[model samples]
Target: MSHEVIRHATMDDLDALAAIEAECFPPAEAASIYSLQSRLSVYPDCFWLLANGDTIISFINGFTTNRPDLTDDMYDDATLHDPQGEWQMIFGVDTDPRFQHQGHASTLMRAVIEDTRKAGRSGLVLTCKNRLIGFYQRFGFIDEGLSSSTHGNVAWHQMRLTFDEA
Candidate 1:
């Protein structure tokens, strides 16, 4: 692939990121432009973009969390700021349909994993649907079993990747 595949998202990436999210997820799972804007403003370090030449093919966005648990409340309430937190909570990951099966998500995910590790943080954490357990395991994320908190009423699997494991 000729895609450069790495970039720190800026305010200008909002539209592309939102578009990817809309295409890859259900309506409720999609992140709004305003929310993406807010996240970029506070935690640009947690947002990453993967580009194919000039077009954005995939991206991952998240925030820093003090607690180990990936809670549903963190999805909305923006005032719960915690930049000094030890854990990174990945909120959304999406790849444009055209780029599916090309390992773009894995490429972007590695960037986030390294970003968290280089920050001296403990590690990165994320939740995905139950069917995706093995998909994350390939990247070294251990299945922590079932998660209690449900987003948009959909059950999600809580998986974690520790820096020590890498």
Candidate 2:
């Protein structure tokens, strides 16, 4: 991981971010370029990217909200972000196909958790498919059972990593 840089996102990253989102998720699940742009403009600090030299290999992004549960509307609405919110909502954790399983995603996740904790947030929340529950669990996230979110029309389980428990 030497020389691999992790930093907050920028408007310049919109193209690369959108491309990675397309490769990492189904069409219905991927964020549109426009939405990505809006989010980047509104809350760039919440987006983190891991780049191996000049190429982005992975990234994690989301917004903050006082709302404890993740809702579908949060996915498309950048204005929903509240910088002072208690909960940091994770919208996506994506790794490039060519770079999967190389610990990039895990590295990014750790960074997100540490940053959120430092920001004085109460906890971090994310909704993931059943297959990913264990992956998130490794970071101290507890499965809160099925999420009410119907994003992408897929069943998701909400997970939380409370700073108090960490």
Candidate 3:
């Protein structure tokens, strides 16, 4: 692992981020370039990118909303983003295939979690497949059984990590 830096996204990263998403997910499950553009424009601060030198290798992008669950509508509509919302809804955790297993995704995820906590969010929410439940649980996200979302036509399980205010 050569010195990697995690930072918030910018419009300049749109192409690289879209390419990574395509590589990490199937067309049906991946976010379209238009969708990515909308998100970046609306909530760039919520998108964390992990870079090795000048190359972006992984990222975690999401939006804040009062809704506790991630719905398919949120993926395409940046209008749903609320900067002061109570929940941070993680839409994707993308890593370049070559960067997998190097903990890049984990590093970005931790950054997002800490950033959200510091922002006074009530919690963080995400939807993942069955195989990823354990992976998310390691981050303290509790599986809330099956999700109602049919995003990408795939079955998803809702996971949440709540933060208690002192």
Among all candidates shown, the one with the greatest lDDT: 2
Ranking by TM-score: 3, 2, 1
TM-score of candidate 1 to 2 decimals: 0.92
Highest-TM-score candidate: 3
TM-scores of all predicted structures: 0.92, 0.97, 0.97
By lDDT, the candidates rank as 2, 3, 1
* TM-score for predicted model 3 compared with the true structure: 0.97
Question: Better model by TM-score, 2 or 3?
Answer: 3
**lDDT (Cα, tens digit) per residue for candidate 2, span 69-140:** 889999889999999999999999999999999889999999999999999999999999999999999999
Supply candidate 2's per-residue lDDT for 59: 93
Candidate 1 lDDT over 1-166, as tens digits, reads 5737588888888888878888988987777778777877777767788886779988887888789988888776555658888998888889999989988898888888877888888887889998888888998999998788777778888999988744
Model 2, residue 132: what's the lDDT? Answer: 95
lDDT per residue as tens, model 3, 1-166: 6888889899999999999999999999999999999999999998999997879999999999998789999999999999999999999999999889988888888888998999988989999999999999999999999999998889999999999777
Give Cα-based local distance difference scores for all models: 0.83, 0.94, 0.93
> Residue-pair clashes per candidate, as listed?
0, 0, 0
Which 10 consecutive residues of model 3 have the lowest summed lDDT? 1-10
Candidate 3: Cα lDDT at 157: 98
Please give the lDDT score at residue 28 for candidate 1.
78
lDDT of 2 at 145: 98
